[model samples]
Target: MNLVNMQRKHSSYLLAFFTSVALMSVGTARDLRDVTEPKIPPSCTTLKASGGDDTETIQKALDSCTKGKAVALSPGVFHSGPLNIPSGVGLVVDTGVTLKAITDPALYDLGAKTCGTVDDVGVGCKAFITMLRVTGSGLYGKGTIDGQGNVTLIGQKKSWWDLSEEALVAGTFQNVPRLIQINNSADITMYQLTLIDSPFYFVTSIETNGFTAWGLTIIAPASARNTDGIDPIGSQNVTIAHCNIRTGDDSVAIKAMTAPSRHISVLNSHFGHGNGMSIGSEVNYGASDVLVSGLTLNGSLKGAHIKSNTYRGGHVVNITYNNVCIVDVKNPIYLEMDYVHLHGNRTPEFRNIAFNNIRVLSTGIFILQGLSDSNPVVVSFNDVHITKGSRWSRHFANVTGTWEEDASGHCGYAGNE
Candidate 1:
């Protein structure tokens, strides 16, 4: 305790470690834009819309509805088949209703019939609003749930987006049927619903654990085929907010194949013409704390995407994209790791990615590939703005900061389908 009282006790321990790192960065920015807009419980049974197969009357009012109530559905057309949704109940759909989804591949086969066919073991159907192993379920509404996928499958003639483009010209896999399938669920939700034309993947959620999709709206067609908008596989503490998502594939895919998808959050979304906020081509069991905020991507074909390969590889770390904008996108910032080249060894790790205040108002193509040269792909950029003839490419990525071409703003939502 000599030298000036030991430098005043090391300046009070660096002022209490910078005040505990500014309170843990404001609690991780409120856990990445805290979302929560779900409250619609209280109805335990409403039904009304018997213009045909209401799938055993909405599966007997969601199997006798009870736990935390909700069965509504009133208003109009509802042709269901393949329902489920039990534990903790919920399933609104009011305001000029529409439910639909009865393309009848034997009502979503899953019984060795290989569903709408296109084989190679595509999991044979089943999913027109299922919520297996449920807990605190949900699906509130303001209407639609279509999945008509351009209707025409009763006996099959194609249409489920033409058998998903004939299973991509017979390379196999297409058992279709998926419009809200929430497996092994827990605290799931999907408020302000709309979800349409999904012959497959439009709100998936496997191994879920506290999922949430607020102000939803999804509408497929950009040549719909695997119309995904809001997938959250191997989920955990997920939250997709203010959704609008016009899809045809990946409007918001954040998969982690069997487990391990960490605290995710996508806020203030908009994305039109899908394939925009993606993260992986399966992601075999690895995906870390992701956070995308205030997105906008219009006419998207890919913007802020992160697709993997090496046969559904793993490990995508602390991803973040803030205040994005990207208009008329066509690969705005695609981070690929040999996406379709497949081949596996399980090694596909993208590192601490970050891009704040992005802008990119046109002139697309900025693919940043990696998975070689000693495995690079660690990114970072701060006020990234891109417009002037934007078209940059990278191979063994490891980029960091700086990206301005002076992007002129304007992406206040105006994305159609």
Candidate 2:
């Protein structure tokens, strides 16, 4: 009634609060487009294990599944132990289903005593044939998970006088157990699986969400020491596509701890040998919108790796590597921001990295740098092509950033190409 009726009732309550925030952002994008592909039910239950040395107890047939149950395994060799797939469990392994993992590490600690030892590394209590350990939210597995023994890491061959008696001999080295461990699960989907010879770290997705491993075939033993195929730790919207990784270590490693890592995409993969396609030694807690495209590294020691650890500080932004195909790799495009064997507290900045159209056949040495100099990490190698294979040459030690080498020179700084 005064001052023009109180400014017309405060502009009609700010136009009804912006029309309820644009109708709640179109109802949250129509509930994420109605949950984009998550509904694989039809196959109620059938847990059968006849031969591959059947001792079948697979965590009592996955605790006799109830929530959207589907445990159909019948093609033998399921010594069964350490399979906790409760919460909408749907484990199916049809074509010659073999879920072996009973090399008998004392049958779940008879007197093994929960063995523990780290760093000096003599740890044992060995009963981790994980094969499936999902925590709720629609877990799905499809076939052939063979984590049979021979995964040795007991102090990693204790030299130096048996490493202080294997670090005071508690359990003396036994960490071999990780076929499929998805803790804190959410909308997990594994398709056409065949993880073989997994002594450790075949597929481990910790703190998950909408994770996907498609057309998988992770094989161990390029020298199968610490087999790492698919490890998405502290995850988010992850998608590891068309996989066929031959592992000894680091076939796919994308990790972040206290959130920041977002939208990971590894496409058309066929990484070879091992220790390739990595992001962070575990970037304390910082990563964003990573996209690694169409990789096919054949015989790798290092290809497309971005490690950080001068002392545990983190920041990797908008990483994008496109159309990579490095054959006979040894330091084929690596960016180590003072990895220093990954200890802690290191990060000035590893900003907005982008490597496009890389095709190197260098048997050894093609741009390996340790960035430092007051926080300098802005790599941009566009259309890189290195083919010098006489025995290594191209090198860049402690990088300071800004190398716009494109006209093929293949990358040179140690006396300029």
Candidate 3:
């Protein structure tokens, strides 16, 4: 349908559904980017990279670092294995330094002979940087953390990305390490960090509260598999702002795997060559109360997506996207319920999603699919302008509100930081 000032025919039904309800009140609004950036703490200790393995030196500094202080890595190339960050401490990679992860699978094996191999259960490798059960801990720097996904393994001919492709063909999973893993931790921060070429997901947090990712630059090749930028899983009160992410998978994926993920905000971010902002294929618990504002997607595979199948499905509500711009994106607005054709008993719900002041500069396929006719996706639009030749494929959706083809306004889109 030509989305020109379109109004829902069943407006009365929606009005009755929300007559006494406030949609924005569905989840808490604890945006971490609402405050100013904190000053970098003074360094408790600084260590120059030895010409050999620096994992022991770095780990020792972090383990002995004082609370409310950071351990600084001097400006040099440092090769290391897995490193842990203690609670109430920080790690800093100073400018002109590149901390590269060693490609030895044995160093990352979790006592399961699954690292550097393919299997059905792929969670077998530990992250390069682990923050477990920590509070007030962070990674701050202007330098880079290079996972070296393209580098060949110590004893294998294939690199990390090559193994990922092989696993896809073999119908299994590649046991590769993630760059950063934050688990069971609270009040964590990642500031001004440049992450590149992760073997798996770049940064992931699970069951943690009060998380923030600000001024992050993440990049990966388009062919790299499973390289998600930042994923907040089963976490609440989170914010990701001023990020420029280009990855193989979702730039920012909000998931509810272990618990309900709620009260999150993603503001003023730019995406390129990735599956843009997304809300899970693992939302089995629920995900609610998310606000994404002042965003841009350029040359992306998908933009503003929500994908979930019956096996990993649950309630997704009270999401808002405001002041967004898209250019040369393929699937502009994709919301699917039968993702990957996974089938089960859990029903998926998408409700009260709002898009305001959006502009798409290129024509692309737009999809909004729900599970069934009885469980249609509920969404609204206001001042959303797309290119004239765009095509829409909608199924089992109650698309309401207004849209236009006059894409003249800029939507206040500033590219990236």
Candidate ordering by lDDT (highest first) = 3, 1, 2
The TM-score values for the models, in the order shown, are: 0.34, 0.32, 0.94
Scored by CA lDDT, what does every candidate get? 0.80, 0.60, 0.87
Instruction: Supply the global lDDT for candidate 3.
Output: 0.87
Candidate 2 Cα errors over 4 Å, as ranges = 1-70, 75-204, 208-216, 219-229, 235-250, 257-277, 281-297, 300-304, 307-327, 330-333, 336-362, 370-372, 375-417
Encode model 1's per-residue lDDT on 1-417: one tens digit a residue.
Answer: 322233234444554553344334323432333456789999977989878898998888888888899889888898988888898989899679988888888888878988888878788888888898889988897898898889888876777778778889998888888887888888878899888888888878887888888888889888887788887888888888888988777888888889977788888878888788898888899987787878888887888889888889898887777788888888888898888897878888998777777888888878889978899887766667788877677878766546667788587652211
Question: Looking at candidate 3, what is the lDDT of residue 254?
Answer: 97
RMSD of each: 18.3, 20.8, 2.6
Deviation from native of the Cα of residue 65 in model 2, angstroms: 2.3
For lDDT, candidate 2 versus 3, the one ahead is 3
Cα distance off (Å), candidate 1, residue 176: 33
lDDT of 2 at 87: 65
Question: Model 2, range 1-417, lDDT digits (tens) per residue?
Answer: 322233234444554553343234322211121223344555556666655444445556656767666667666556564555666666776577667665443443425443322343434433343323454433345567776635333334332223223433654444335667776667677776787877567787776766777778888777655578988876777777777888888998877765545677777777889898887766677766677767777786988887877665577766777667676677877776666665544553566566666666455554445454545655544445556442332223322112222223332211112
